[model samples]
Target: MKHLFLFLLTLVAFPFSYAQQAPFQDEINQFKQQDEQHFPPKNAILFVGSSSFRMWNDVQSYFPGYTIINRGFGGSTLPDVIRYAPDIIFPYHPKQIVIYCGDNDLASSDTVTAKTVFERFKTLFTMIRQKQPNVSVVFVAIKPSPSREQLMPKMKQANILIQQFLKTKPHTAFADVFTPMLNDAGKPRKELFREDMLHMKPAGYAIWQKALQPYLLK
Candidate 1:
């Protein structure tokens, strides 16, 4: 009877402990380790979101004259970013924040609508404003990926919603990387992407660089 009771107690507590563990915790810890070694410059432009920014290993080269701290991790959804904001966002005290998220939120589940993405983005924006009221923010519009072609409508709608929301706030801008990535036939430009047809090649990043340049702070 004692053994059975102990086993039942373990079963009851196991799932709860597992559920509380955060996603991408290892990545966040790595960032913390790097920071401990040598902290990043304050007031640099911070790019935080999903794999799009994470995979941009040479983002600094494209910008030429600005300091950039790229904290994008995993195939992160907006909620993941919000969960890790204290670790990734607030510490840097960035002069500007360039976000490339939301499409992943839509792709994560069919139930996630454009409005859901919009609201998530608003929550992220509000959190940032509450912590650092004067920091500039630039949201990179979700690009049309050939692999996720079906989700484009949701992406576009989320883009429109976020763009409209940003207009109402000060020190904010929307970087339109979406329109340029689409071909003349209004489809995703396949050439811009890698063989995966999802993540971009250099060509895609080139378009993003051009779209985002005007918005980056000095």
Candidate 2:
């Protein structure tokens, strides 16, 4: 009885402990409440990752006839997504999962290498497969941005690794948003971004929409 009681106590405390360490507790809580009121339908597309997806408030409009659920939170890294996977990812029975995360992982001030980012992605990918064995996963290539120009080399390396990994997996697609976002000079185009030069403007998102449109399943 004591061991069973201890196990139940751990279960109760685990969520609170994770919440304290998780970057965006309030955002996760709000998502939970909103979902309870109006639950997202099963077999819809789930877009998750960093601020980029969160900032895409008009994502559904871009897809036109798709059921896209955006669970993106700002400043999220690969590990952060892994930590919050249960809340944002595992609950929904999404037909396809479109991810856009490695950008912030490489762009952040922390010291993580391209290989580290790739492995983190592999972990997340494996977890998703374990939970939803047959779900399609579309990994949006770690984009190139003018603001983080210096980190482009590492970002490209990570994108390459992920793209290759996805090619080896079934029902997976790597949306190469990075290549088209570049200019003739092989650099991020200022025209594709806002004044901040970090986030996408309409031009960049247009490219993303085109690249991802084919893989989307409504």
lDDT against the true structure, each candidate: 0.95, 0.90
* Model 1 lDDT per residue over 1-218, tens place: 99999989998878577667799998999999999999999999999999999999999999989999999999999999999999999999999999999878998898999999999999999999999999999999998999999999899999999999999999999999999998899999999999999999999999999999999999
lDDT of 2 by residue, 1-218 (tens): 99999999998878567656657878988999989999999899999999888888899999888899999997889998999899989899899999999888876765888998999999999999999999999999988889999999999899999999999999999998999999999999999898999888877888999999998875
Off by over 4 Å in 2: 1-21
Candidate 1 matches the true fold with a TM-score of: 0.92
Worst 10 residues of 1 by lDDT: 12-21
lDDT of residue 152 for candidate 2: 91
Sequence-dependent TM-score of model 2: 0.89
Q: For every model shown, what is its TM-score relative to the native structure?
A: 0.92, 0.89
**Which number leads on TM-score?**
1
